[model samples]
Target: MTVVVTPLSGSEKLRLREVFASVQDSGSLLGYIRTYGFVRFHLRVAIGKCIDSRSVSKLESFIMENGLLDRVEGNANVHRWSEQTQLEKGDSIAAGHMSELSGYTRISVTQNNLQELKEIWDQWGNETKQLFYGNYGNLPYLLDVQIDERLFRALAQFWNPAYNCFNFGEVDLVPTIEEYTALLRCPRFQVDRIYSRAVNVPTFWKKLMAITGMSEQWITTRIKEKGECKCISWDALKGLILTHPDETKSVDVFTLSLYGLMVFPRALGYVDEATTDLFHRLSKRVTSVPAILAETFRSLGTCRKAGAGRFVGCAQLLLAWFYSHFRLIDKVVCRVFFEDYSLLKDIIVSTRRVNVPEENWIALLQNLQSKDVEWRAPWMIPGEILYRCGSFDWVPLLGIWGAIGYVPLLVLRQFGLRQFMLATHGLTQSEFAYRGADYKKRVGEISSAWNKTCRLKGVAIGPTTTLEYVEWRGRRVNDNIPEPDVEGARPMEEYLQVMP
Candidate 1:
């Protein structure tokens, strides 16, 4: 199916003509938009609704005439077409190998365990629950979320690791920091104070001691090293939640366990030491949104690259975020807009769509269009974007387990801003596991980068994109290697295919 482009209105065309006449250097228009803000409404007009094909062709021709397109920088002596041919060949071969593999593996997240955690939380005294609510803001509600593993498995197949988003035909969607922060709704979290990997890391027991106000000896006894990570089992934490003498200390321990098991579950039943380090920082008001987003992106990319693997990230929160965008239900009540109302709770309870077969889900997503997506969730009021880090060109995100780069510039439309074709030079190279020889060096670099983040204040206008950005996106889609066809297989055989 072909993408439908939206034609510009006569008024919009007139406005564009005026802007074009005012520009002293046509080539500098891109720079001008980058420096001083452009009114998003006056620019491309709307997202999903793009400039018509005729207008796009005319715009490109006009740009060429005005020498606005940047010249390619490379050795003129090189065989450029031959180089392109070689890259295409490599991509085709890799895609072929990937297609031969089985479908997406089921995620390993323990929903039953989360439900058990919720049952325990329900049994807590009103005072204990109030303490958690005051600080965490409806986080306990996430335990009640029922994750659709089949839906997530199908969603995983559409992840484009190179671009760091889910590429559903013409629609590109990703969970933004603003959306997650709102969903988390933790009153204690300071958005400006982000978490980063410290150069001198503390031991798991030391961090736990600080959080729980427990003796070092006690913490040391419970700490168990599991597969290169130091973790404390849920059973140990559950015991404290029920038996601890100090109410505040017990709540703190329960909250920490929630972060390990629900927010950033690296293991099945244990809270990893890395999670403890991040949790410790939270006491000082550091926001966990970026770290949460980083792990989600990292896990998705890992699963996509391998074609089949157990997703280790937080499945419930991811599914909640997904539902917020592709709303299957009707408009939630006006109460959802109130400060006291828990949107997460409503989503968890209201999301009762029947299980969709994996292949059907894949087909539905593959045919997704911009018109089909709710670009911004209903509960989200657009906020300033963390576009660049320090003097770094792109934003760098630090996760508990690793670091990866984010191109907020590419996703400007998510914040009701005009999207443009900003150069994504080193994004793919920025992802790295936290256990390399230069792990410390990499962590330090990302930490320093976060310290220098640049936030673009959000404008109150509709989302739109430039013609240049649309053209660039089209090129990316064209260049992408096609997945192998899944045709001619018998229905029974398709249904019986193993998820792994």
Candidate 2:
């Protein structure tokens, strides 16, 4: 005999709810599962209904045996009302103009001349390139990424500042620290030695002197003020990369320029003072992943809330991360997975440079479904997740330019674990810059909080969520599930209309 589990009809749903209630009252659901072999049926019927805690273990075993875990984990219902409310609150807090942002603001990306950097890199030998890669990973590949302005604009619209992930239709996707670290492939990054703002930071010229071994006179003369911060022109950096006596110093200057122009380009054609501070710390073996992610989230949140602004974060890296999740490239063969391979290089080569219309991209993202998202990036195989701050609730990240917070518990499904409604009460409160009166105190507090980060080890088998977690997700107001837009037309109608 064969068994097929289908969606329950209205009457069937009512009957299943009553059955579950009676089983909970009698505490015989575990006995029922073992005797009747109705495990799959009951699991399917338990989507929004509460399951008896007594039967959870048996149900988990059955789910694992039948390979039905993904289906059960992915069946979360979309809660539209909660998503909208959260978005509004986040926007109000960030920009104070939520009512005016009905349509997305046109995004302005940094126009850095990476073609010049790539040309300079192309002149280096394999040994020289390897030396550079040893410190910075495959950062040079970012030069190959032709910025897709329209796609990024559309992509920016879906960024939910409330949760720090892209909420497209019914899907939730965020670029995690682990994913960025792997993509960087830099051997120098130590996960535990993260970057945080110090109470007393060194001057930009002094930091530059330490990095380049240049005289204080040389560094101070070259530094120019750009807006509120100081910067060194690319011409000065280029001269050092080409004519500097020491090969190591030349490489260091080149890497610094890359971080400024490519990764965190606050000012075009120059490396910012903040970039120098971060690069100085990088020399001390500090992990750049969290700082990179923090700036990325901060910039996206700023742009999203204002409904428009120039994106000051790394566009190439963001686009690369975006393409990895949405595009269907060739599958990775077994050998490549075990051997040395560059996932960022693959993404840059595979992604086409065609410019899709901004409206079309927006329409497509707005209509995204669970089936459309590749939850886990193929390159990501995390052994564990940095889920909490020491003993605090969620992790807080401090960037060179600003700060923000994210809840790793909210995104467990991205790591192939089950999703749940995690507590996020104080996350938004942590979002601020280094300029406020209490900014120093806030940074000090967050920096201390990082000392006690708690990690959850990856599980090989069994359900990732508890009975209480599943129940909470089912009953929670602000759920992660995607729902129809306010207009209530067919979900794909707008998408199709905007497509070529």
**lDDT winner:** 2
- Give the per-residue lDDT of model 2 (tens digit) for 228-322: 99999999999989989988888899999999999999999999999888888987789888888899999888887787799988888888877
Give each model a TM-score: 0.74, 0.75
lDDT (Cα, tens digit) per residue for candidate 1, span 178-269: 77887888888888788987878887777888888878888889889899888899988888888889988888888888888988877778
Q: Which stretches of candidate 1 lie over 4 Å from their true place?
A: 1-112, 329-336, 458-463, 477-500
For model 2 the local lDDT of residue 407 reads 75
lDDT of 1 at 2: 61
Top candidate, metric TM-score: 2
Q: Which stretches of candidate 2 lie over 4 Å from their true place?
A: 1-102, 327-339, 460-500
lDDT of candidate 1? 0.66
